[model samples]
Target: MPLEQIRPSHIHQYQNFLEKRELSSTTVRIYLTLIKVICLCINNSSYNLYFSMYSYKR
Candidate 1:
């Protein structure tokens, strides 16, 4: 799906999918972190910014 159309539900679903694949917990966390960073970059946020993981609706 397009970035503009991405929602918190999608992220949650992706997390679930990754977990089902038996990825290590740490790896899943890193992937989610990277995803948050990418979303910030896509939104043109400053590199020094921060985001709360819970801000996204599961």
Candidate 2:
């Protein structure tokens, strides 16, 4: 998927992916943080707060 289609919750799923791959929590947080910043940049809006993967899994 395009990076633009990615949202904050996608970052969480990515964290879960990292976990399943035995990545560290700190690493997960770092990746999520970067993804969050990128998503904000792409959206060109800072109104987004962190979102849970469950919220958008539908």
Write model 1 residue lDDT over 1-58, tens digit each, in one string.
7899999999999999999999999999999999998887778655434444435666
Each candidate's root-mean-square deviation in Å?
A: 9.7, 11.7
Assess every candidate by TM-score: 0.73, 0.56
Worst 10 residues of 2 by lDDT: 45-54
Please give, for residues 1-58, the per-residue lDDT of candidate 2 as tens digits. 9975766687677788999998888987888787767666667634343343224763
- Prediction 1 TM-score vs. true: 0.73
Best by lDDT: 1
Candidate 1: regions farther than 4 A off: 48-58
Give the Å shift of residue 16 in candidate 1: 0.3
